[model samples]
Target: MIGEMKAQQEEIELLLSAFDRLVEIPDEERVVFRTLIERKTIPAQSHFVLIGEPTADIGFCLSGLFRLYYTTPDGIEYNKNFCGKNEFIAAYSSLLMKEPAYFSIQALMDSELLVVPFRNFETLFDRHACWEKLGRKIAEGMFISKERRERELLMLSAEERYRLFLGRYQHLENRIPQYQIAAYLGITPVALSRIRRRLT
Candidate 1:
């Protein structure tokens, strides 16, 4: 709900390339555009954004972990996302519609982020075609990953899910705890242990 982040005014060109090759931005235009970036950092177990909260900023992680989750009537948590370095983190649906969000983002580890607000995003996109391309590519990438996860969930067994989890996020499995992995996989910790034992 807060648009407190101010563009660093120095890192835009470098950040832009994180989304795409950015060979299209003319040198003169790029020098001008570089003045519009800002950095944001969110701490562990903290809310980067909450359910029903306004979505204003689009953020890219410089480091650390965050998850998107929703609570059920019985107060159980279901994590729908896991993201870290170089990843873009935002409630895309809410950001696109300029509405309140449905999912809550909580940092699993201390995080440093780079962000551009909706106002700046709109102004930049309208004025610079290069920024628009970067935005479009980020959205497309997120869509592809979401679809892939949906297929994996529908087709894979629980044990297979655990194996795939390891294969996909090798860095995360070793860093986070087993219980968190179980929660992400929709399994009990005991079952996860059994799966691990079988693998060994």
Candidate 2:
């Protein structure tokens, strides 16, 4: 009763905060956006997006962690990024182009997400100026993040990259498995162990 109401209130606040990261949502539009968004809980190891499948929804993480990864034909998996609480998660390339995703997104823990269907979300771009600005801001943020990651991958040493990873995602270090962290660092588990030993 009271506990459930408090939990719901907390989740609503989190959702609003995430939306505000893109643009300030007007009171009237906020109500409409909240009405359209849906809440989903994904169990550990389940996927939010799958390789070769169209991404129909974009989600904001309410709680828990997700890994965005790509698999080669040989079945080797490489983690591209992790999305944690309050961050947006989407196969954006696929979402924008209406094509199958090249990467997959999976929860590393039981996670709650606030999701909006891409079709419904896209309609807001044309319907409202605020949403249009929000869309552009999201795009610019993604591009900047991508470029920063690219530079780090190309120029940083393995140890340096590990340090950068720690700086960027230290909050996730204890929450997810070491092997996934190793994969994101493009290092073997044994190598990651050595790096950890050296850092400590």
Clashes of 2: 0
TM-score of 1: 0.86
lDDT of each: 0.78, 0.87
Which whole-number lDDT from 0 to 100 does residue 64 have in model 2?
Answer: 91
TM, every model: 0.86, 0.92
Q: Which stretches of candidate 2 lie over 4 Å from their true place?
A: 1-10
Q: Candidate 1: minimum summed lDDT over ten consecutive residues — where?
A: 1-10
What pairs collide in candidate 1? 7-37, 7-38, 8-37, 8-38
Candidate 2, 56-85: lDDT as tens digits: 998889889999999999998889989988
Give candidate 1 regions above 4 Å deviation.
1-14
lDDT of 2: 0.87
Q: Pick the candidate with the highest TM-score.
A: 2
Question: Clashing residue pairs, candidate 2?
Answer: none
**Model 1 per-residue lDDT tens digits across residues 19-69:** 446336656656655555567779898988898789788887878999888
